[model samples]
Target chain A: MKPSISCKFNRFDLLLSLFVVLAAAALALFFLSHAGGEAGEVSIRDGDNAPYSLTLDAPRRVQLADGHITLVIERGGVYVEYADCPTQDCVRTGKITRTGESIVCLPNRVVVTLEGAGEFDAVTG
Target chain B: MKRTLAALFLTLLLCSCGAPREPESVQFFAMDTLMTITCTEEDLDAVHHAMREIARLDALLSRTREESAVSALNRGETVEDAELAALLTRAAKLCKATGGAFDVTVAPVVSAWGFTADEYRVPTQEEITALLTHVGAGGIGSDGEVTTLAEGVSVDLGGIGKGYASDCAARVFKEENVSGALAALGGNIYAHGTKSDGSPWRVAVRDPFDGSAYVGALSLTDAFAVTSGGYERYFESGGKTYHHIIDPATGYPAESGLASVTVVCGEGLLADALSTALYVMGEAKAIEFYRTFEEPFDMILVTQDGRVVLTEGAAALWDTSVAEHSYQYETINKL
Candidate 1:
């Protein structure tokens, strides 16, 4: 009696393997890039410009194109007290006390990032 | 032929399944602050391993924990941890070098100010004087692995634990095949390698008077920039401010005429130790220590009077253009 086993690698098998590998790579990439920030730091942007950082330790109102953004530092915390935008979403975002928290008003092109000092790639304390 | 195909498929699957992507980040709280590890890696395991190691050290070194090495000493027992022994030994050397400025046995004095307990209090002279007896690092006894402190004396590695944490993280980064990474423990920073962009890391010298503003920035790579500041952690009592860094001799907050001291060098532990030591040593003594130091290191000091002085070699690190607040920058020689 004789017994034989044969293995095959078809084009479809190769394509399927490639697809699986690509999908896994894509998923990992998505998650990796999404790992952004922590703490309470605010960065403002106007349209297509770069973000201008506003120190959370410094409490002051910022003037944007349309409405004004008020930043208040009270009791060792920073928050967006008021935004003159239409949706009021920025105000509703509440105070961000932890790392990686941010508030953005699309209408006013204002972005407030509550940057956590310790939760960064590199922090100079 | 068929075997090759199977092997290739297995390899692909195995690589895809367990491998973590590069530039992965991990953040957790340890050593009384947020410890972040951002590294170039294909697996999170290395970063996780680093975190576990650091957390273990944190537990072992914590003065507040009953099971910690220091706690063991406080209870008149000995410890047998390699890292603890090494830390205590190095701290002893630093204390001697800085004329007992960086004493681990200053724990009683530090805790007396309520910085450790979160209950701020100004200890009376009598209280401080009593605590000062056990203040110097001369009490730390180590024999290779096992170590002990003098009876009634305790140790606190807060002066250098974070720096050692950064060093441990850097080692893990290398073992994990991470090319470039940053390990930061509050004001203690270790730019393990250059940035992902292959440029030097820019670290700001925080304003000693204000947390929100920086006095200047430092360009560094493969270096640790650790700062000891009166403003880092402080409490106000009756219009007077008391900081966490205590002077062993006086049993009080150091009046070294320095608002903050930043030490930059290749070694994280040294930078951390030197920053604290130099802060307590003041400018003149620090310059002397610098001259006598075997290895090269740079220092940036913000005096209580608002003068910024850096070793001549340290100018490359400080970016005067980036400071939000104006500082009177002074360049000092190796005197």
Candidate 2:
């Protein structure tokens, strides 16, 4: 007894379905590989006037003011706190969620970058 | 089912084979340029030794040298040492390059202004000109290991010392066969290769107006980047600003549109000197000076207006996304 055309078509459909699943898996993996390249953050200090610190708060408020800046930590990742300038750029630099993220204020000249919280042996004496 | 299993195994095998290997980590400090060498732990001792050597060079070439070798030369004494000989030779070249703008012999003026210590009081014009009369590159001369100085003259190589140290440390990296590393002394930076991930090291240029902000980023591989700014040391009095980098001619702090100058070049010595020269020359002359030379250096000049000017090469290496804030691209070369 010979198989019907419908039965043959069903077998082909199953093979096609398997191929689609395998390709999807590979695509997902490629995305992950690219995503892994996202790296550590860097903090830049402007060495002029009064030295102000711009710290990364995972999530919270940012304040900018006259040669002074503070980062109010709202949540756990990163955010800007204090600044006393007209632009309030530091305050506008919302939250830093990722591992290597930054918040920068130009008017006050503060930059806060996150690079894996742990200090890697680069000590200055 | 067997065929499908074979295909799956092959895919896994290919993925594993194509995975990227981890990169090495190298570390050290000199010329305010902290170096991190990424290599095997087997190379750690060599790296440490090289770093200490660099620090020693720093002590020798620094303003502290007033107590070290430069003082001996200043007091009509002759001293022939490997460190002093090398430093004096480099000083001569830098002095010529800046057309006397980057003189190592300006220490007498530096001291007269009371900037050598924490004393930040502004000096009177008479006091500055009196000292300037004795400070110039031609004040000191070397005759094959024998250094002689004119009366009432002193030399200060602090402006160019860290850069020289950085260059020497880079040589150590090369001699030790380091594949990749970065040295950053405060704002001075040198690199032998990219990070383990094969991306160029990105250095931030600080804004001169506000110390807490960055002007922009400079991406470099196997190069050096050094910055000099007015705010490094200064005191404000009587509604006037006084900075550290003084004009060799006027015996007063240099005033220009540039807030800071960052030079990227092959050696730390050049980066160090050029950064200072540009600081003194300001934006216009700095751009002209950079263009006149055929060297492979790129410069980032930040003006007091928060404007940024980059050499064509530097612009290509920078991360444009962050540069948009508090910075507008300015090509001062045409102006």
Candidate 3:
């Protein structure tokens, strides 16, 4: 006689378990094939100054004007934590989510934009 | 039995990942351009050492730096830097080969055009003619141990200095057992060896007009690629676009009708010099230059007429499918 452990599971139950496993496998496959690239960079520009590229993986705060404006990076996004600008547009702009997206603070003359997270060896330009 | 077979398959798959991690990278600004050095994470110390070596070379080569070798020689002092002497000797040979098209002594003309100081202006014909008097490789003298410059002539290694520094950094990386390293000093690139995963490294050629996109990719291993273009640095004065690449003959920016030129060679210094030389030579003469040139290199010339020209042998080195389709790809036969 087969063990009671095997008898506890009938054909229908086994089929249901198999269906669940198959669904999870399909979802995993979908994610593997369709997941977008991660946030690779955050480029910042202040006023008429040159743009600065920084790594998005590391979390840090950028203090400018003796902490008048605070730029923070968290969870692969960069957004202003505080700003002394009159309108507070940068602080209200919230987080950046995708490559090519940007948050601009006109009064502070600050710009934070996202760039594609590519696996390039080196950029020629 | 089926589970045992599955476990065996998993073990085989795990053993196949010989180089699972991407090479580590370090970026910094020097030589008035952004430089990036990439290698395995364990070779971080070696990368730092290489960057220091590059900084030393930058100080020694910068013409404006007060105590630099070029500046000292310009001040009529017999400077004693082995690297400077070597560079001068090489520059002399390049100038002779290109018939002064590639001249380090063109610093006077370059400055006269206001490019060196970044205060762009259109110099008068008389001003350029007078500056051209001091703009030839003949004004430089190197005696294998010392370097000197003639009066009014200054050495600007802007063309080849970055390449030399890349080569220097490469040597340091090799000494430190970092075989899979790539150093990009501005528009110059040097691949130290095969990739860490034992595959050829893929490098791209950028479109002169479009900075963000690449025109094509090259499969390089133990090679150097350098490009010189007028698109990146230029100023408009009175409806005229004056670029930084001054033609020693005309005492003006090269009107060779070329947007850019990229040279692939085994030596970084040679590639750097060749890229500028080809751009100055333009299309017709550059084709002639390539046929008779003895050095082994592949050339890619982007023209102002919307043409992309390549040396006859470049087909094997580039990715054909991903090449830019906007411009027709033309190949010149070796004359």
Candidate 4:
């Protein structure tokens, strides 16, 4: 006669397995959310001061270097609206919409860089 | 079974906890450009120290700063700073190595073109000729402690300052025992170590023709790479375009038939100087130089004729999958 075996999971076992599954899922989601380059933010560095970041979800005009520089964020694009620096190279950079692009005003010691996931860590030219 | 499941979950959590933390980045302006240094959060102090070091060098080396040692030398004063003297000596050596293709004594010509003051004017041929008289490595003199310049000659370290600054940052990183770091001082880049994930840092070579795209990317670790291109600084006047990389030979923009040149080596200063020198050397001569130079260095040359040429060493780490398909690619092996 063939013997038949039956296995049963208790309430504690089922709860424990479910908890493990949920916890793993939660960890995966957390990592996915915190991955680099997903956040479309604009980072501005002025001299030795602390860097400032702004989300690109809205349009805004930001004055920097005590009104010496005027930065504009419009329609997911960033550009230098006005700069009192002599070179005006910052203003000539035009608008940067993609990640990794930057406008640097050497005289003012201001660098406005677009932060997100870029193809390369740095650009050399 | 329940115990096994619990152990697995615990292991997963521990693995997640052990993963590398986010890097702390410090950005500032120095050497007349934007500089960004990134390292582990625990090594943030080292980054700050590096910044201070770069600032000190800038104060000492800046040509525009009246109190700088360079300014003193430019004023015909024998500046007695050992650091400045050493740098001047090194600059002279590099200028000689490139057969005077790159010279720090081209400062007057650069100023005459209005590039230094941003006045934006095309200097007359006669004016350039006069300025060229002062443009040569021999114009700088040093006695290992004091530095001097010829009567009409001045020096501008703009071509190599950023590279040397990156070298300073690398020195700091090494002293602090930082795990991994990347310092980008304008077009000069020094990769201290691999990324936290153990992968090499990826640096893209900007396309000379297209400001928005890149010609290729290089994976680097513990290396210095510098790219020189006319596209970075230029002006258009009277239907003519003028760039800042003046050929010391001609007192004018280098018309070497090459758009850009990237030099990769172990030393940041060498990489920086060679990039400019090679760009001025053009394609054929640059390749010949690469084959004959005793020091090991890799190079990438983007020519005006839509060709991307890479030295054998550079080709090993180059990734052209994302490069513009319009340009044909070539690799140069030692002949």
TM-score of chain B as predicted in candidate 2: 0.86
lDDT of each: 0.73, 0.64, 0.77, 0.86
TM of each candidate vs. truth = 0.71, 0.70, 0.78, 0.89
Candidate 2 vs candidate 4, lDDT winner: 4
Model 1 over residues A2-121: C-alpha lDDT tens digits?
Answer: 887656878877876776667667766654444443333565555456667666555666655444777665434556677664445456546656444444555555545455433234
Per-residue lDDT over A27-65 for candidate 2, one digit per residue giving the tens place of the 0 to 100 score: 658845544433333344442444333343344444434
DockQ of 3: 0.14
Q: Which stretches of candidate 4 lie over 4 Å from their true place?
A: A1-33, A36-39, A46-51, A61-70, A81-86, B1-4, B7-19
Give the lowest summed-lDDT range of ten residues in model 3 chain B. B11-20
- Candidate 2 residue lDDT tens string, B1-335: 76567656765665654544443444333433334444445456656766787767765555544566666776777667756766677777777877777887888787766667546677788888788889777777776576777888887777777777777778887888776666655556776776554667666665566543456676678888888887655767799878788878778888878788888788787788778888888877888888786566778887888788888777776655533256788653322
lDDT of 4 by residue, B1-335 (tens): 76776657774985586455676677777767778887888888999999999999999989888998888888989889898888889999988888898788999998988888778789899999888888898999899898888899899998888888888889999999988998998879999998787889899998888766789999999999999999888888899988889999998899999999999999998899899999998998898888888889999999999999999999999999878658899998998
In model 2 chain B, the worst 10-residue window by lDDT is: B26-35
Instruction: Arrange candidates, best TM-score first.
Output: 4, 3, 1, 2
Error of 1 at A20 (Å): 35
Q: How close is candidate 1 to the true structure, as a TM-score?
A: 0.71
Error of 4 at B66 (Å): 0.7
* Error of model 2, residue B308, in angstroms: 1.6
Interface RMSD in angstroms for candidate 2: 9.8
Q: Write one digit per residue (lDDT tens) for candidate 1, span B129-168.
A: 9989888887889986899888768878888888888888
Report the error of model 4 at residue B48, Å. Answer: 1.6
Q: What is the TM-score of chain B in candidate 3?
A: 0.94
What's the number of clashes in each of the models? Answer: 17, 42, 0, 1
